[model samples]
Target: MPDSVLVAYGTTNGSTARIAEAVAEVLRRDGLAVEARPARSVTSVTPYDAVVVGGGLYTGRWHKDARRFVRRHRRALAERPLWLFSSGPLDASASERDIPPVAGVRKAMDRLDARDHVTFGGCLEEGAKGWVARMILRSGKGGDFRDFAAVEAWASRVGAELVGEWERSR
Candidate 1:
């Protein structure tokens, strides 16, 4: 197994959590010890050698808890390698060229000095959403458009990076 890795994520309706689990699976398959947990579940960053932080987007903002987590552990995160990702942009057709960084994400990238940052498409369930979220879904503004293949590919890249880091340290 490779060095311990923490895959922490924040979700609104659970899409981000699903993405985090998928990422953790990819790392595990690559032989890394990975732990996937919600932002609130993480009491400290002292155990993990590397961290991957993810969150869902709402109104051009990441979940507040995620932002706070990063801010709280910025020092520990900076000492180790850290990556950030966001699940947003409802339109599946929009490529990376079409989607610019959301303000919150951009700010976090700077604050965390993240090694990498990515944006993934998110999911919207019309039937399961609350009034406000359902309205957003019904308005045709948000939809379930996550690209699992891309997510997997990115996870592979992360795995590669972790392996490389492990090798270098030895």
Candidate 2:
């Protein structure tokens, strides 16, 4: 229920950034001040009332920047409300159960007392690669599986709680 939020994300091919932007848009719509930035670019979360950290899951681990962001700001984040997210799993079935597989991040979440962690379906453009991607796109396989509706819905829910918390404090 912070008046402001910082959405820090780490992305490789940029899918994670898009997801973070979508979440930021929803939070802004809810009348909360929000800033979305790449995790590596963020040096501090001092100005924000809440923090949302997310990253792309690659090879059963979160992107390094995102992990480092949490580690660097763990003390500050633990003093405020925090949330975590991971964007990966090109298929619906896989996304439903996709959680970052890192003990360090899990420990970080525990330290921050994170409010929640969500896994969202991701997009891997076949066009992003050369020949293989084109073939996949043509076959309509492994395209963008991200559900914008779901992302917005979850963001809206978080917004409601956050706004309510702010109001109560006021």
Scanning candidate 1 in windows of ten residues, the lowest lDDT window is 92-101
- Candidate 1: regions farther than 4 A off: 93-98
Error of 2 at 145 (Å): 1.3
Clashing pairs in 2: 126-133
Candidate 2 local lDDT, 62-129, one digit each (tens): 87899989988889998888888887776785446545535656777788899878778777774464
Number of clashes recorded per candidate: 0, 1
Q: Determine the C-alpha RMSD for candidate 1 after optimal superposition of all C-alphas.
A: 1.8
Report the CA-based lDDT of candidate 2 relative to the real structure: 0.82
Q: What do the candidate models score in CA lDDT, each in turn?
A: 0.84, 0.82
